[model samples]
Target chain A: MKKIINEPGKFVDEMVQGILLAHPGALRTVGDDLRILARADAPVSGKVGIVTGGGSGHLPLFKGYVGPGLCSAVAIGNVFSSPSSQQVFEATKAVDGGAGVLYLYGNYGGDVLNFDLACDLAELEDIETRTVLGRDDVASQPRERADDRRGVAGIFFAYKAAGAAAERGDSLDEVARIAEDVVVNTATMGIGISPTILPTTGKASFDLPDGEMEIGIGIHGEPGIHRGPLETADQIADRLVGAIIDDLSLADGDRVAVLVNGLGATPLEELYVLYRRVDEVLRGRGVEIERTYVGEYATSLEMAGASVSVLRLDDARLELLNAPAQSPFFREVSA
Target chain B: MRTADLNVVARRALADLVGYADELRDLDQALGDGDLGVTISLGAGAVIEALEQLPEDATAAELAKACAKAFANANPSTMAALVAGGLLAGSKTLVDSTEPNQADAARFVRAAGDNIALRGKTQLGDKTILDAIMPAADALEAGSDPVAALDAAVVGAERAVADTKALQSRRGRASWLQERSIGLQDPGATAFLRLLQCWQAALHAAPAERN
Candidate 1:
């Protein structure tokens, strides 16, 4: 509690102000609402615009994706809450080009309502709109109807594909289709070792035993499907990859891009350990790993856990996956 | 009947809360993340700043609107959003009115409870802030006088906080404790209850009636 802060209420505002101050050229806020985080040169013309939004605590998911060749705009909600319709509408207006706009985000209910509202507003403004929801978390719901699953780190893949499609001058409908395809091919599963603290309540979102983990935990502290004794790095990875593979119906000889993502408090060393095991599992299954991304692509602030996302890749998808993407949270390396 | 009329109460509650915020968070550091103090302080600060700029002669509900706006704009964290959700729920009960009656107050309390349930998915006995908040609301609704109602709420909340030690942490960080959390009162439940007690005492002693 000795941390330096002006006042608890001012933390987000001050933090938002500080972020803007630190990167004046990189971001701009819409009016008094801090939720709408947009690119500096927003409202690009002739090219389709991409926008994403979600709760605030997951730093890089919604806001961090707003940049060149990524999301043109992002509407940030409070931790675990969806941004208001007005915030989404403002972001839509800001990012709308002569070409239509695409509303790409998770399948959370509040987000669905607000983004739907934004789409209505955009239509009124003569800006065409398409939406692609990312629901790749197999842990949340069953795979027979995976659209009900929550979107986790796998959303980063959809963002990349959609952003690249928009950059390539594809229409908004084409971009939305490309993003939806990625979502369909993607599957994710997470394990939680610890819980996140809710800043306002100053309490943990959930609890775990010293030597146990909850498998299939949601980022917003939703109860996981099961809890069990602590397992080694390889064991945990095996469980996660096994669930994802089964959920996605990946057959032998399938190819994919792998993302081993940490849930905030998990260290790179541990993530790499899981990554190694996952690599082994996929290789053992004869699944070719076209690309591998390891690190905190998305997070549940300070929660100790990790998630695995695999997107079954075809040639076209692989090309888009290999395309260059630069954001505060992502970097691409040329092969 | 204007929002400005409630500024005195808002400022006093907020200032009083700054101390409570720091204290609550400090206590939470023992078992929680220690954000309660700072987040509440930040929320109060937002309201205080908003109050200073609001037009004079506003009503209690108007003042409440400003508070809600400040919360919506400033504190977007999950915890803040939960608090804001409950407050907004309460405010919605009186949005059309300039003042509050016992029925309106009761409606506000119920709305707050519902909002918290929807936002946090917490139930009583989960050793969450609801352990204190729900009973407090029920007591307030049943009390004869507003001050007495709030006082009853304070007592119910205090008792609930004490009983939390026996209950398991079902929702947040305390849940991580698993079974070890049995002996410790949830830091969030305690701080929130304590703040309410303080608010009741101050409201009982205030010179103006918030008319």
Candidate 2:
């Protein structure tokens, strides 16, 4: 439970306050509640609002993605807990322009419950909204039960694509359709070598021995589908990327975008090592890699692991991916 | 009644509803995490306060939306969220209405019940709040007279609560108890019944009973 902080109870608030102070002109809180953060120039006149929310631990995740060409607003919750429906509604109101709003986030139960309830509140305010869940974690559920899969780092692709559509003033239905299409095309799998200690309880989220690795682990330290002794970086990449590409069913000459993400404790260099193997594997399969991102895009708190996500891309999705995006933790220049 | 009467009656009904919080809490402790009592008490107080601030010219839809926001924000639990969502859904039925009647009450309750059922993913026999809510909705729809409909609602809600004692828990935390939940009173269903009873008493009791 050793970590840097003031009071454990004040961890989320203090961190958020620091972020607001550091990036005053870029991000701002909606209304009086600090839990809801929106782009400074939010409710962008006529663009469809994309509001994403989830727990707090995953930095650069639900919160860091709020900026121009990304999510319009975000409702943050406590570490590993869903935000209240009221918080979600406030974010909805904060980012809702004349065009409708969209709720895009990972597929988690508490999040689903709170956001769905927020939809009702939004309707009462005469604000139309649609929802597209990120269900890209291939290890969480089988293809037959894909809807039941948990969302992981692959949601970044959805955010980028959906945000581009909204930036171009796409209708609410079009934005949601684009987001859902990205979610369906994306596949993610991770391997965990360690676990995280929850800030509130100061307890480990899970237990794993020093030399063992958890295959198909979720960002919240959810148990993986399989566990065994640790393997080399290439071996780990093979397991994760192998599972993802297989799930994606990538064909020869088909194009895909890859994300090699570090789960908290894993270093960037280690991510590159994983990406190198991933590159070889995809190239060997005769699949064309159009775009590659290798870094800490999503992470569990202090968990030692990395995940590989593949988005089977077409020209439209590629163009959307290439569109300009800017956030506190993410940025992309227009092609 | 006009929307003006809606404010006073709703506030009064919620004030009475808070009185049953302890009873609901005790029932929930037997089958759940034992927060239902506080959730109801806090939610009722919040709604009552919110209704107090609404102007005399407030519409029927405004009344329900205010209550929904206040209740949900007061104690942002799963129960609070579902109840607030139900209220918001029910408010849609009154969007065009000013002076709501008995038939309008039925429509609101039915919409609320249906919304809860849809959001909670529970059926009528799930021994949840919806168990009592749906039956009370049916009772409200069956009556033509306002007073009789209120009485019928109380009766229907009570029967649903009683019937829940024979059914295993099937939704929310209570369902985690599995078959062991049988023979115990359901907290959510009982809360709905208590709500109806409170509404009935609010309509019938003297103004001095607001205390």
Candidate 3:
């Protein structure tokens, strides 16, 4: 294509190099692997080394989550791919202190295979490791088989809680437990208006008829369960929220942190429209909205869709989520 | 084509195909983000690099395996993995000592289609690369010459790409456009056609030098 690039083959390398150049004080590349972004002051002694890995293009999820009180390391794959096992292993070793390391990522097959391999490699290197996979996308799979669910933007909450717990001197085991707990309590559903292209293929991954939207599509543009004429923002919100409500089995008197995330191309106005309805639905159910975040917190490369994540929160979980934390992508309020 | 060295043909095909991706990215940005060039280029480069690591006497099968593994390791994007899956499927054809004499070529088409099905979860008439790919495979299975087969494949892919304008895209970013996707060729279909053109040229020139 007529674009400013030295070579198409080196695009990812160039992008990673540019990120390192721009954020010199905040991030550093782990050797030649652009996927592994580590903190400037890495291997924080006595602090559990928090790590996350996922496909790229959804910036700030795995990488943006890397900073003080968050991930100490992030292994970025190409868009919608998992990082190489070696890259994950290298990141684990780089971020490892005497306190051990926790490998937190999604539950995709490739990611599982590579990260599990990374764990094996890390064990050989004498780095104790724990793994936590986020399966929060209730739209993807049923709650009875939650492990089949895809990890979505709701993972930001997990990172927040796990990061805070690790920052406060929780051991690797404790951090893993916190992440698992967050995963268990979280449920998400997404609606799609448009499908995005994978940069390499220059083709759409899925299709929707004009004036129509698909309910419960997967992040990779896998076919959703159903397609229907486009509905109003409120109607779309009801469908998405209704799925979450049913999947999560929430009843009255429950409290949850809400995150309505835009999938890359959706406008702020539409997101607001969805959020307004989401709030109304939760209120009608007597479900307390303890916290709310509305933005492009996670995305598919320029896909016009949005997902709703509801993290059922308790007093202890609420305290950790609200704990003061700072990162280039997310900021938390102090308890 | 019978006397052609398959490895040399495959390598040239890959290198030339990456150049096509570089060209196709320009076309894609009109309808998609400027990534087809970058993604295909990255995948092809990884395959080329992996080829270098192969044994000097490596068969076409080993070469294909190496390309698949390397591309998976290097890029890990869904597209890369999908392409790698196609290559892996094609590689099995190369290792078959007893084929229907022309099964390698037929196998290539089948493998590519299988990868698309598994990775993208797309089907024919969805205005995808399969539009071009499936027809081309059918023509090749009828024993068309390699170059002619590839040319046919390119033609199929081009027609499929053009037809994408009328059909609602079943996948990718264009899916959101609905009928508004009219007037744009499917970029993936376009890229596939470009690769086939290069593949045709590489195979055509191979037999001439063998004599």
Top DockQ: which candidate number? Answer: 2
Please write out the lDDT profile of model 1 over residues B70-123, one tens digit for every residue: 764564445655665566667767866655666676777778777677656678
> lDDT (0-100) at residue A201 of candidate 2?
89
Q: Candidate 3: global Cα-lDDT?
A: 0.77
Two-chain complex of model 3, DockQ on C-alpha atoms against the true structure: 0.03
Q: Which ten residues in a row have the lowest lDDT in candidate 1 chain B?
A: B1-10
- Model 2: fnat (fraction of native contacts): 0.50
lDDT of 1 by residue, A55-103 (tens): 8778767777877778898887777778876678778888888898899
Tens-place lDDT digits, model 3, residues B64-95: 66776666556544455556666666766676
Please tell me which model should have the higher TM-score, number 1 or number 2.
2
Worst 10 residues of 2 chain A by lDDT: A117-126
| Per-residue lDDT over A217-246 for candidate 3, one digit per residue giving the tens place of the 0 to 100 score | 766776677888888999889988998888
Please state the CAPRI-style docking class of candidate 2: acceptable
Interface RMSD values for all candidates: 8.5, 2.1, 8.0
Per-residue C-alpha lDDT of model 2 across residues B1-211, encoded as one tens digit per residue? 8888777777888888898989989999999999999999999999988888888888898899999988887887889988988998898899767799998899999999899988877898888998899888988899879998889889888888999999999888889999999999999989989888877877786766543
Worst 10-residue lDDT window, candidate 1 chain A: A1-10
